[model samples]
Target: MYSFLENSTDIHIHCCPHINKRSTDIFEVIKFAEKNKMYAIGLMDNFSNTSGYASLVKKNFPNLNLKIFGGLIMEPPAGGVSYENAKISLEYSYFENDGAKFISFPTHHTRYIAIQEKRKLDYIQACFYVPDSGPTNETTKILELIANKNVVLNTGHLSPKETLTLVKAAKSLGVKKILVPSNNFNKTTIEKLKIHNVYFEFSYFFVSKATEVPLTHIDDESHKIKGLTLKTLKDLIEAADPKNVILSSDCGVSILPKPHLGFYQFIKQVHELGFTIEEIDYMIKTNSKRLFRI
Candidate 1:
């Protein structure tokens, strides 16, 4: 057992398994969480409402000792990036236990796909567009819904410029919590996110060789940290500074180690790289709870 995580209120996991062809299912993830005594675990299924599954697990497995939350990924499968679809997903699980607490921008259908596929400057799906100028009437509708619902919004795979625009719009809409899934931003962008009071997530799985995650280059050396080396990620984290930074295991793929194990390894590696346990705890534990309010 990883004693460090036992009943640890400082460790929160963002992408726990059993969804999207992952190695483990909701039930298995719950067992893992219970065994490890995690603080909280987030369930995110691309284009589907998996919070109900998390709700069911919590209902049936009353003895499981961990907090499990769920969210919706706004993609084609979940009816694209439309306000109506986003509302439906929000209402679908909003009444269950803690409700669906998260709503992500397009993930698989963002500019990340264009970069990953080496395609022209186009999104994976043209349903929604977050222009460099800012949110449009259609985009504002979704942002307003997110603000009204008080759900955490993730900047899913959008380019830095687009993400900054979206963040500004979200801030204008009075969004409580805004999370960026990557650390790939320039110092200016990082400062901007901080100014907007957004949470910047640094995922260990992205840089893990076992996961083979794809990365896009940015102007800063820190933005190029993804998929480079763990030390580079460590450097990026240090450079990012603390405050709203968060540490999460975007681990679910079969090729990588299990989420809990991989996260433990990440913490250990970072500690060895010079970060103190208190600093790591703040990212995994404090910032997570603060973001999700769990």
Candidate 2:
């Protein structure tokens, strides 16, 4: 029988100095995972490629028994969804092993963030621009590239309409895995995502009342917005199949619970709300392992 900690693999962890002022560094994150006996952690550095760094760190710390994965967020910092950039990142691995396990679309620099925060239109740079017909030609090309690479695609802060279009196109192009950030998902699109086998992720960072990552570090105005309620999460879980659901700590802010504790609490709360252990395991562990291909 696997221990409780053995099952939880955190797919979202914001480390330091990547747009968001994260409390933990790559090394600290690994230490925490080792101490808690976690299987893996995905270093979600905003607008940066942390995959190579994470692989190097793991090599340096040969004694630690944790898998660290990293990827590029197709935001401005990552050269904004260019095919060449994506190819370089996707090919980056330890020797022949694929270290770049996940690839997310724009996060802070999305049109959705601009509208939500009332930022200037020029402030946000999107991975793909959509017109009345559908995603632009460039967007389609990028989707094809992503599909061929077969990396996990995270819908980072894209509006519901954009997410729907992107998911539909990505699936048709052969992108096997998709992940939608927690609050970004709504009832209208749940069933559609299920049809495509896209995974909807739930995180504790936004919901935790206690601010951990210090408001000073979070430059994005959306972080100031209130997080979704546990009830909302429950509804989302019930609405989707257990296999297509993923639970993670989008945790790393100094003000919130550490990754392990936040993840544990997320499970505890959902369980208290009547989510079965099997269901929780599938979301928190099984789905993430499959997504990260660990």
RMSD of each: 5.1, 2.6
lDDT of 1 at 159: 75
| Per-residue C-alpha lDDT of model 2 across residues 1-294, encoded as one tens digit per residue | 645567479888876455544566777777778888898888887657778877787778877778888888877766676767777887676646565677777776676766666666566443244544666766777778778777788877777777888888888788887888856576767877777788888777766874323253225443354477778877887888667788888778766667777778877787887878888889888888888688
Give the least accurate 10-residue stretch of model 1, judged by summed lDDT: 216-225
- Candidate 1 local lDDT, 213-280, one digit each (tens): 43322111112224547666666666566556787666665656777777777677767778777787
Off by over 4 Å in 2: 1-3, 19-21, 124-128, 210-223
Pairs that clash in candidate 1? 10-285, 18-24, 18-25
Against the true structure, whose lDDT is highest?
2
Quick one: RMSD of model 1?
5.1
Model 1 ranges with Cα > 4 A deviation:
8-21, 94-97, 120-128, 211-226
TM-score of every model? Answer: 0.85, 0.90
Residue 167, model 1: lDDT of 90
